[model samples]
Target: MSLKCGIVGLPNVGKSTLFNALTKAGIAAENYPFCTIEPNVGIVEVPDPRLADLSKIVNPQRILSATTEFVDIAGLVAGASKGEGLGNQF
Candidate 1:
């Protein structure tokens, strides 16, 4: 199974920026709050030289690198549990 990662934090705290950098998805990182209401899902290739070497030795038809899923969710505020900042629905 693939691994999933969720990015959660307060508004305008660079969470989007980090996600954009990691996934290169060109997601907008606005300066204001609540800019990212919907979640941004992306896959990142995991770099492992050992895997490449093993593939070379085994001579597989194709080399598929492992991947991880990154989910950039909306920001959370103080009252997120109580529906603040749109709550857990994000």
Candidate 2:
């Protein structure tokens, strides 16, 4: 199974920074709204120090860890879908 998550909030809300920290994508901090149409998606490996310990205890053939994805979507303001102040066009 696969899972996905999206990072959404007001502009300059630090969404990209948070996504970069989570996914380590190193997205450049250029002009606001980088990739106005596309968002920066990052896949972050879950940090689990106990996975190996558990594997050793269980003597499993393999040790697997989970991962998470972070998406830095363009900021969407209130009533955006309704075209309220440069909202519908985006």
Candidate 3:
């Protein structure tokens, strides 16, 4: 199973920057509020030498690396709990 990590923070807080660095998804990280309405999902391969060694030893037809998912949710503004600034839809 793949692990998922969600990035949640206020606008212009480097949430997208971190996500992009982690996943290299090239998502738009604008300086304005509510720039990302829909969440962006990215899958990243986890590097493990043990897994590679096992794969080499077993010689599986298809070697699949462990993966992690990163999700970039829209920025939450003030009064978000009360349905403000992109609201609870996030």
Candidate 4:
């Protein structure tokens, strides 16, 4: 099974920085609010000790490791319900 994780927080709160470090997606992480208008998504394989041990014993042609999806969503702002500060767009 796969898992998905989203990084969300206030504007310029290092959300994109953290996402970039995790996924290495190289998205435009500017130093301003709403820089990440579009959500950045990336999938990375999860390292499993069990998989490695199994590979040694079974010697399969290929091993499919589990994966996790990380999404960097735009920052959330106050008054979103009132459609303020581009919050509604996000």
User: Candidate 2: how many backbone clashes?
Assistant: 0
Stretches > 4 Å off in candidate 3: none
Q: Worst lDDT window (10 residues) for model 2? A: 29-38
Indicate which candidate wins on TM-score.
1
Which residue ranges in model 2 land beyond 4 Å of their true spot?
1-3, 31-36, 83-90
- The predicted structure with the larger lDDT, 2 or 4, is 4
* CA displacement after TM-score superposition, residue 27 of candidate 1 (Å): 0.6
Give the range where candidate 4 is weakest over 10 consecutive residues by summed lDDT.
81-90
Which residue pairs of candidate 2 clash?
none
lDDT of 1 by residue, 1-90 (tens): 478999999999998999999999999999999999999999999888898789878999887888999999999999889988779895
Report the Cα RMSD per candidate.
1.3, 3.0, 1.4, 1.8
Q: With candidate 3 superimposed using the best TM-score fit, by how many Å does residue 75's alpha carbon deviate from the native? A: 0.8
lDDT by candidate, in order shown: 0.91, 0.70, 0.89, 0.87
lDDT value for model 3? 0.89
The CA lDDT at 82 in model 2 is 87
Model 4 Cα displacement at 24 (Å)?
A: 1.0
Better of 1 and 4 by TM-score: 1
- What TM value does model 1 have? 0.90
Q: Going through the candidates in order, what is the number of backbone clashes in each?
A: 0, 0, 0, 0
**Given candidate 4, what's the lDDT at residue 52?**
82
lDDT of 2 at 28: 68
